[model samples]
Target chain A: MSRHLLALRQATIGDASESIAAVLDQLAREDPVGAQWLRSLDWAELRRLAAERALAQAAKTLACPLQKQYANASQYGTESGDPPKGTCIGVLVGGDTGYGSSVQLGVAIDGQALSFFWNVASQEAASGTLERMRETVRQAFREQTRILMLELLSEDGEVQREQDAAGRTVLRATLVVGGGAR
Target chain B: MTTKGTITIIAIPKSAEVEVHIDLPEVPECTRIAARMQAVLACLGAPLEDIQDLPAPRQRQGVSHAMRKRVRGGT
Candidate 1:
């Protein structure tokens, strides 16, 4: 019998302003062309851009077979007939505490989902947290997941404010084995 | 019969609160998967021992019986 796996990846931003700024700084250094547009964006625009970028990065890591321009949900695997029995991986970000933000990421094999989270209160902390989450994604791919789905969400607060707020972000995943009934 | 499993990992970066859950069918096929998960957690520097175990689901019949007895002997 063939085995199947699925994994989910996610992240949560407690203070969008700080998180956006941090992401923008990184982008400015990494992608000069994109940085130009990012540099001119206001706080509100930057927040939107950052969220989109995060989801895109997650999708890329999953190697989603069907690529879509929208940020939020994406599916990978087979389209027709019985999907091959294999593994799946997912990443998520969530848990936004007032002091900082928390990010969660992981993979699911068969019906099992394994996830990890990181909380950062300061920009410095966020930098490290992002790197670790990225590394976790790399590791999940090495483990071999056939299908991946990524979801992202942000809480409501002062959009332009720089202060951190209390909130929570959850990253969840589900898997099915043997390509059985879903 | 089909076997299934689930695992969840939660981490708090500030206070460093981390929680992991693993749910699998009570069968041998899951052994290798579990071991691989443990290895992944190790590579991530997450302690395997710290993962909290989820309580087994209560029997539906037992719950119903308890509810019936409680209703008959209303407090």
Candidate 2:
């Protein structure tokens, strides 16, 4: 399993309005310790805390389950000097498929089976065609995970295709989030 | 709007392997995120062979909380 960090830099989450208060009250009812930890923060910090639960869901969905032990003791500031807040999560990036090591995590689309990517050389495909394919995959993936990635769609993002020596391909997405520190 | 950060998500053959940024910009709706995650899992074809409600966690000896929320991890 590989580890990835979801870093946040002074993103504004707004004031502790009544709605947010209600949410915190509910959180307290469920997890008082967490609520206490969250309540101490201003809206900016609260917004950062919100990522905690969301990330847990994300990690769980990826089969690379989120472990609290991996959480950094983010009590210090960093080079960016903005608290350097981040959550380290274990990611299952590669695995053995018997024939050899494969990054094909065995996922399907629209409940349809996918052909082995190694058999189809991405280099042979036309540049535009490959880009289209990659876009199609990205769209399908976004459509499938719209809920978890709700806010990310609005941000300009890019997708790249990565292939190892074994021709194993991994589609990587980099989504930039606009700061909402209102 | 200023760019605050970037989330790197990897998508594998499993259409659902895509990593979510979960960068809390404004709203951090836990229920919404959980619902979406559950949907993503279903989309990934996680076998749903069984449907049993999780048992309530046992209360700690002297703790005053019951932790009634059914969330898998209160992270």
Instruction: For residues A88-176, write the lDDT of model 1, one tens digit per residue.
Output: 23334532343222333323222222222222223334346556555534333322211111111011111111122443222333323
**How many residue pairs collide in each prediction?**
37, 2
Question: How do the predictions measure up, each by TM-score?
Answer: 0.25, 0.21
Q: Is the docking of candidate 2 incorrect, acceptable, medium or high quality?
A: incorrect
DockQ of every candidate: 0.04, 0.11
Model 1 chain B: worst 10 consecutive residues (lDDT sum): B66-75
Candidate topping DockQ: 2
User: What does candidate 2's lDDT look like per residue over A31-103, in tens digits?
Assistant: 5544564455453322323333333444344444333332222332112312223322121122223322122
Q: Please give, for residues B1-75, the per-residue lDDT of candidate 1 as tens digits.
A: 544444333333333333333344442323333343332222222213333434433233212111000000000
lDDT of 2 by residue, B1-75 (tens): 643322323333433333332233333332233333333223222211122333433344332222112222110
Lowest-sum lDDT 10-residue window in model 1 chain A: A145-154
Score candidate 1 by DockQ. 0.04
- Chain A TM-scores, per candidate, are 0.20, 0.21
**Reference-based lDDT, residue A94, model 2:** 25
